[model samples]
Target: MNSIPASRRWMYDRMYTGRRGLKESFVHGVEKFITIACQQQSYVNEGKLRCPCAKCQSTKIDGVHTVRLHLFKYGFMSNYYIWTDHGEEMANVDNNLIGASSIGINATECETSNSMHDMVCDALRQHGAFDILENSNVEEPPNEEAQRFYNLLSEANCPLYEGSSESKLSMCVRLLACKSNWNVPDECVDFITKMLLDVTPVNRCLPKNYYDAKRLVSKLGLSARRIDCCVQGCMLFYDNDYGKNDGALLQCKFCHMPRYHDRNTGSSTKKLVPVKTMFYLPIIPRLQRLFASVQTAGHMCWHYQNRSTSGVLRHPSDGEAWKHFDRVHPDFAADPRNVRLGLCSDGFNPYIQSTTPPYSCWPVIVTPYNLPPEMCMTKPFMFLTCLIPGPRNPKAAIDVYLEPLIDDLKKLWIGVQTYDISKKQNFMMKATLMWTINDFPAYGMLSGWGTQGGITDKRRLYGVGKVTSPLTDVDTLINVSSGRATEESEKIIQLEEQVRKSREEARQSREQNKRLQCQFQSLFNVVLPLLPSDTQHILQQQVDQQSHDNHDDQQPPPTGHYGDDY
Candidate 1:
């Protein structure tokens, strides 16, 4: 009745190869014993198995004696120990139940043993194998849902001999994500590829190498169109009108900065330049891709129905700006498919600290705020809209680079013919640039609002006549039609102030003229009439003289005195 030490108990726990096998043996033995007992007189009516042991025969005691008792005491306890690695008594039921060389209460020679017990013991040894064979022989009906999943696996066309391309792609993508998330080196991709190809089955077709794998990944990702930009960060190669005119270009139209360095050109006929390329990923296709999946499309619409409006402003949607936007453009806000996007940009040095004179790069990112707040701000949910390649920040000229984006946004506002994946049809897809998120410097660059003013001044400066007209009348509207504030809001405020000041000055000037007229009338009617005709003539002559002096001197009278006329 003593227990084994904790350290040594693991050996007892792992005595069997598989715990499942042990469980099966115990189950089959009990079932076979019941089958044998039922063959005898009224087993179910009596509610006990007729044990043929000498002890049971003499005492008339009958039940599932060996099977239930041994299984409950040994099998269950052994399974616990197998999991927890702690038990007092080791389970030795397998050898005992199999009728091996062990002394027991019902010990007897096989030749003289009860046939039922022998058969029960034999069944335990070959327990689950028979059931497995039976299941394998039975065929299950095919299912439609299962067929779709099977089709996904079949898309890769890898044979059973080799691993499926779907699985390999999944693994590769996971590895790449991990590498990026952990800031691991690019070599990790090569290492992973080599390890997989070497250790995995030979027939499998992976990427030829890491570069090929990268290309495959790019193909699977959002499509990017590269546009050359001025090295001075002056402008993008494609303008708002560049799409209309296909004239050849060599330099920036505005700054006349060369697109490429002179040394980059080859002596041969081909001209080469140090490519300052900006990779722009169109938002419409990305938005369409999100809707292509049923689950994601459903999640994207969650903000409309499930969003909380506590007015504490947990998300941008809860703010007054968003409300104003909705109010201004009720038609655009009517469709949940009309996405609201938040833009973000920040500059960083791609090289490590060890590198001297680091180069700066700015990546523009956009988040679809149409998703719920929890999912909307997550890194994976954010989309890379463009790369603003730079040694220096684009500053106020970020708009020049944003011409393509603004143009596309205008197109979206006008209604781009887009394929609605969920509806399985083509329709107009419109989206709005709800707001931008950035630091102070980036704010000035993106919004064109300088940092020379206080917070209230900035607000008033931005919120007045400078406000962009919410109509797509021009290419420079920059989502003004989406109810976003613009430079015109400031101009409108300034104009109103100018009109008020002009009106107040005119009113004051008229009041001053009325007082002067009243004074002149009093002098002529009361004082001048009392004088004689000659005196009047003399006074008139003096008044005329004073008027002439005033006109010549351009001077007003002293504080309390009129001229000699008084």
Candidate 2:
């Protein structure tokens, strides 16, 4: 801390104005502005003399023309840590602070001959970095696809920078949402890439894996939708009871192999469509909302004659959709079938199955499990729906601009086109449902399960554990320590261990019966079929009769495997 000593008071007086304002002369820490302003006044009064302040006349403190803003948004943390969106270097680092990185910020003082606010805001905006709070133009009339993509990107609030913990999570989501992995129409992809690259870059990207994962996914043709549910035996998670577990679609890689969803069901139909099913479990609300958005978009698109890849055209800036795509390929511009996308109120998930190859799930959140208590009481499996990104990393190309994707929900709401319930509604599946509202703070250590009235504590404004929403600027990222899950897992292990002792006694008879059975044949064959046909038939009949008797008895299965899948 720099201070003006008693001996230096004379120097300070000569250096500063010592302005004769008897009302107030408050001196707080680092009052550089007052110092400079006073110097300018003194210089003007003293026969236009040069301002002789120690800062201007001597090398007392570090000599650098740096601009710093007192970000009240950071609360107490700002006392030590400086926050910046620009890619600049930090000369100050203290043990108590998480220092700043220069990405998306102005490190070099811009040479603009304007006020500090104008200079700063202009520099930031020119580089695609603007005070998000100052402008709500994100919803301006974007051309067709531009509007669609923005709606998808707006699935949830995006946080950036290091001021609040949620900022980190938002940054993570934004970096992960790039469109390059989606094979988006080139114009849309190009436009989104330009915006993202202008804001976020790789190594310094919000989620460090943002770049690597996109690259790997692009190479492997993978999407978060690849995993369905882990608890459903890697099968499609049908209407699970509200409290049952759900596995990630991507984790269940083989779930789409035909053998998973359609192995049985007794029907000889060549194909059966999978209806949208909700398993019994609480998930991030944002996922449900995103699904809702997609479903709305699909509805609007279904009605458009020449557009299938459409969303709400909130903004008119969507340069001619087909024309833009045509720039992607000259011939594509003239192709009649290469129609532009159309997004309405009820729309589609960009990634829906076509019964063709490369089937991938619509991008949604990927969870790390066991969030803290403040998020909610149910230690439920928590995950987010990852939104698709629009373009390249900021590091890849700072000035690139891609075309826009639309937001169908807004279009439907504005009555861009009249709605009709009779219009080819897919009764079984609103497959593109984009989003739902669920709270799963990335850093909420105890954010789920086993809290008071978690069953009854589901209210929003009055919820016991609930807090303010992001757009309100009254939120903070929940601080989640990484080792929390390990602690929870140990507790689960102890509980399971105790249950086994009691269950073992109850399971003895079934275990004994199972030990008496043997493999009927080798891996490839069932020897039970080798017997005479009539004999086999009689055995089958007896088996059926015994099965009926067991059902009448209502006995517990002899073992966990007694009624296992054939």
Candidate 3:
């Protein structure tokens, strides 16, 4: 396959109409989605449907399905979906999935439109969909054990960089500490909190004092009231050793850096609140993480750049956003084609949600790379103007994700720490699934399709690549005309390297996708109805005792194993 030009590639990749019957094509899409879901979620056993739950040894079906709908773009097209047991999950069906298809969003289907506004409106009207997002606002109150863990964390004699809101790191530290020392309930919480938080010794408190304090807070469980924050904030926590001595400034992991508002002084700290770790708090659903990453880039980075009302510095990408920012300085980029932001602030407000420009209000961030400041910050802009399709959020029907479903990563890590040998493996498998579910949104977001980061600016700089084709076939990839570009051995070598890498990724994607289909085909076609009762009993006999089989236990799931590691 020969490489295509950028414009043609964009047009070819996103604009197409399936030649097959619209209904049939739509059906295939939905079926494939369901097949993919199953492939990713579970495995089949000897005539039994076993979820990877450590204690819940029952085989029960979690009712979920994916549906497809059709729409018009001056031409007929189809939409694929994932439905859930909850009716609300399907309430705003069309708008939720296909809305972007109208606005030039080249999904896995590669659908696009010329007029962004028209495409979005068409999708909104046709799909009648709502965002089926899980709100972190709701939670089942934690029990005594879970409460003990929170109290331990609350009394960390020294608080380093901690998000004011409930974030995953806060919870994980508490959960794992509780599990590791669950037996000495009094002292367990303190020991774990100390290790997890890594507070300064000068902050003051004894191990026994740590244990004693928990006794007071133990009465209060880790309920919604206690779980004040979602722990999925933008701040990245780092050890004081790194943050202070190593010139690592304390900053919000998600937002980059946020100065803390002191409780007593009411003054902001030049120092950032640092934490022990900075990797994402796995609690953020994968989709949300993707959106947050991009959104933060726009909100924090772009918003603070040098501002000028004349036009964006140098050549910020968004002409409109650039024009809006030309209030104070010249918009300059190292490349004249590039754009930079100008700065101006309205001082801090107590109710401020983020450091992002005023127009952004949505919780999730859509653009991962630096954004050309949005809109002319003058006059007025619509909420819709700032609204962007961010990477997906983390919350979902646990069924869509693989088993040992973790509502909060803190809880999941606890399960990991205390899991018996046999259970540990099971927990790891579940974690793998969680991580896999999370990885997709990140990858999908990073593919540069979600936002206009890698979008080529034709007029400013036509670094256009090409693939010549018409809207004749939508089922295939961009087709390039083959003339002996193969004559260039160096280019040929590069092409070979590219193909090798692409194929490996595709194979991994294919196999990961195949697992869901295979699991379902094997389940409904073989395991569910075929095995006689006597056979199931005999199979159970092979492992009557739940002990580890002296094998090199760290194997991937027997099935559905395309992981982040690969």
Best by TM-score: 1
- Cα lDDT over the full model 1: 0.52
- Clashes per candidate, residues 3 or more apart or on different chains: 12, 125, 63
State the C-alpha lDDT per candidate. 0.52, 0.28, 0.28
Candidate 1: stretches off by over 4 Å = 1-154, 157-166, 178-192, 239-248, 263-271, 307-314, 351-355, 417-426, 454-566
The ten-residue window of minimal lDDT in model 1 covers: 81-90
Q: Taking the tens digit of each residue's C-alpha lDDT, what string does model 1 give over 495-550?
A: 55675576677667666765775687577768888879999999888777865774
- What's the TM-score of every candidate structure? 0.53, 0.19, 0.19
Return the top candidate by lDDT. 1
- Worst 10-residue lDDT window for candidate 2 reads 396-405
Q: Cα RMSD (Å) per model?
A: 21.1, 26.7, 34.6
Tens digit per residue, CA lDDT, model 2, 1-566: 12223221222222125744221122222243324433432224432221113222110111212211211111111111221112111222231221111111131221221233222222222122112211323222333433333343333223343322233323333334434345455455445545655676432433334454245223311122322222222343322223334332323445443323543667777663432321221222222222122111222222122232456442221224323333544542332211122111111234456764442222222322111112111212133322222221111111111000112222221223121111211111111111123333211211222223322222211222333222111111221212344355444445545756656764785565444432322321365578888987887788668657744554553544211231
Task: Tell me how far the alpha carbon of residue 356 in candidate 1 is from the true structure, in angstroms, after superposition.
Answer: 3.2
